[model samples]
Target chain A: MSAARVGVVTFPGTLDDQDAARAVRLVGAQAVPLWHADRDLKGVDAVFLPGGFSYGDYLRCGAISRFAPLMEEIVPAAKAGLPVIGTCNGFQILCEAHLLPGALTRNASLHYVCRDQRLRVEQTATAWTNTFAAGQEIVLPVKHGEGRYVADADTLAALEAGDHVVVRYLGGNPNGSLNDIAGIRNEAGNVVGLMPHPEHAVEELVGAPSTDGLGFFTSILKNLVNA
Target chain B: MARVIVDVMLKPEILDPQGQAIARALPRLGFSGVSSVRQGKRFEIELEGAADEAALAEVRKMAETLLANTVIEDYSVRVEG
Candidate 1:
């Protein structure tokens, strides 16, 4: 059987593309490097928008990056049910693209936060989180200056009711995200976005306390293979 | 040429940590009884012709779509003669 291919997009000033691709490779998948200017997605099964300060974080964190030519393809592809996952700035981009609900604003403490954090998997039915059990606790690294997740009250209510809130901060509300939401998925269960860097914890050899993030990659591969 | 000014600010319900930090600093600087401070963006656009209703509407579209994220922000546009 052929390996599942995951496309990792690299926007200008993106810092985590290499690590994201490496994480995919570590989980026995082929990592395809995608560029912001390139329109083609290279026929990958899934796409990942990695974390970084894209476009120098101007105007807003993910605001400029979403206008890249590649999004012309990604946005429609995501709507058509192609599995997509975004971490950190990638999460910000997903929101700016309107593929996912809500906006990520600056941290409530008004400072950049970087730490090994704990997260509770709240919805295991989403493509990126199927390998995790509901209420499962996992550790991942989070590093972002602007990570507060916000949305309208109705949207927040819908997400909770629809089982679209995929992850929540387990121990501490790191960034004052409303309802302690660390991640969420779209209505179709294909698109997922989170502020914590799961790719950073995919390999225990990289000084990650546990390889808990490997479940995210494995879960998607399983989903694609079954399809 | 006409100049249009656009002011973008976070909606009243959303929290503004940066603005709160600024408001806190004023008292330490010996300023007193200041209610609050909210920081926002101001964009001054120069157009090729004198401002008209059509031009103002177009600028409003830009503010709605790109210049401001309406999900969390509110924007106002005015012409500067």
Candidate 2:
């Protein structure tokens, strides 16, 4: 079987692009490096926006990066059903692009938090969480300052009504995200934005108790194979 | 030339940790009578012509689509001719 080509986009000041690529490769998929300035997607099956301080987070976290030329294509393509995963700052860009609803805000503590967080998979039917059973618990590293998730009441009700929330914080809510929402999927389930960095937890060599994040890379492969 | 200023702030219901931090620090400096403080963003736009209704209308659209996330923030545009 041919390996799935997963594109990991790297905007300037991106901190986790290479780690994301390594995660993809570790899952037996081909990692395609993508740049922010390029308008093309390089013919990859799926896209991954890694975490970082793109554009030096000048205006806001991801406020400037969302305007990158690549988003011109990535946004519409994602809307057209191309699967995409956005982690941390990438999640901010997703919301800033309006591909996903809600905005990530400053943590309740006004501090940059870094630690392994426990999350419960809410909807296992999505493009990313399909590898895990519904309600499965997993651990992934979350690192961010503006990690609080917020949306208007109507949007929040709609997201809840539609069951589009893909993951919720378990054990303890790290950044006071509204409803303890740690991750969410677009209505169509092709786009997912989460606060945790799943790519950083894909290897057992790191000596972590769980390689819980490996599911994300392999979960999307199913779509590649069936397509 | 005209100057357009837009002020963006979080909705009153939402928590403002950064603003809260500032408020706490103010008391330590012997400041009092401050009930609350909320932080926000300000964008100054320069228009080649007068800051007329047309420029104000356009800035409103920009504020909605980009300058502010209306889901969690409220913004107002003011024109200074």
Candidate 3:
């Protein structure tokens, strides 16, 4: 059987599309390049929105990017069960698109935080996290000026009750995200968004802090194959 | 032509670190009378004609849809004459 094709979207000001594609290829999947202006998914099996200051963080981070032509297609496809993973700025975009709940705001410390962050995998049932065991601690790089995750009390409660909190910050809360939330998944488990850069952690030889991020890429491949 | 103003502010419950930083700096700068500071955005939208009720309503729609994120913010619109 042919390998799964994961489309990595590139928006103006996006800096990590190449890294995301590399991770997909490393996991033995075909990495497809997608542009913000494209109106279709190019028939890829999965979609990834990589981290970066898209549109130079205009209006608000991820706010302008959410209205991109490609996102018009991605939103429906994600709703139809197409697996989608968004990291860092991508996570912010997902929230702006309403594909995910909450918003990523300025870090509580009022500083840009760049570090190898520890995350506890809280839900392994999502398409992008199935390779990880629940409660597993993984380390990945997180670099962002605005990465604090926030939601209303009701939304937060719903997320926790539904097991949608995919990952929680371990060690130190890098951005003062509520409940130490590092990531979350949609109700259908097809969409996942996280503040950490998993794609940057897949290559230990390249001085990546850990190879734990490879699990996300591998998990999507397995989900496609199983489908 | 008429100009409409839209002001956006974070919901009271959400923390505003940027505003807090400014507030902290004020005391050091000898502006001790201020109790707090909240930073927000203001947009001036120009229209081809005199501002009317309909124009104000339209600006409100824009504020709701794009000028601000309703999840964590609130916005108000008024005609600037």
Interface RMSD, prediction 2? 1.2
Residue-wise C-alpha lDDT for candidate 3, range B1-81, written one tens digit per residue? 999999999999998999999999999998888889999999999999778888788888889888899999999888874
Give the per-residue lDDT digits (tens) of candidate 2, residues B1-81. Answer: 988999999999999998999999999999998988999999999988887788789999999878888878999999765
Question: Tens digit of lDDT per residue, candidate 1, span A1-227?
Answer: 99999999999999999989988998889999999999999999999999999999999888899899999899999999999999999999999999999999989999899998999999999889988888999999989889999999999999999989998997898899999999999999999999998888977676986788888999988898898
Model 2: DockQ vs. true structure: 0.79
lDDT of 3 by residue, A46-139 (tens): 9999999999999889999999999999999999999999999999999999999999999999999999998899999999999998899999
Q: Which candidate leads in lDDT?
A: 3
lDDT score of residue A64 within candidate 3? 94
- Enumerate residue pairs that collide in model 2: none
lDDT of each: 0.93, 0.91, 0.94
Error of 1 at B75 (Å): 0.5
| Native contact fraction (fnat) of model 3 | 0.60
Off by over 4 Å in 1: none
| TM-score for each candidate, following the candidate numbering | 0.98, 0.96, 0.99
Stretches of model 2 off by over 4 angstroms after superposition? none
User: What order do candidates take by lDDT, descending?
Assistant: 3, 1, 2
DockQ, per model, reads 0.82, 0.79, 0.82
The per-residue C-alpha lDDT of model 3 at residue A123 equals: 98
Q: State the lDDT of candidate 2 residue by residue for A1-227, as single tens digits.
A: 77999999999999999999999999889999999999999999999999989889886788888989999999989989999999999999999999999999999988899988999999987888888999998999999999999998898999889998999999888899999999899988989999998899988887654799989988998877777
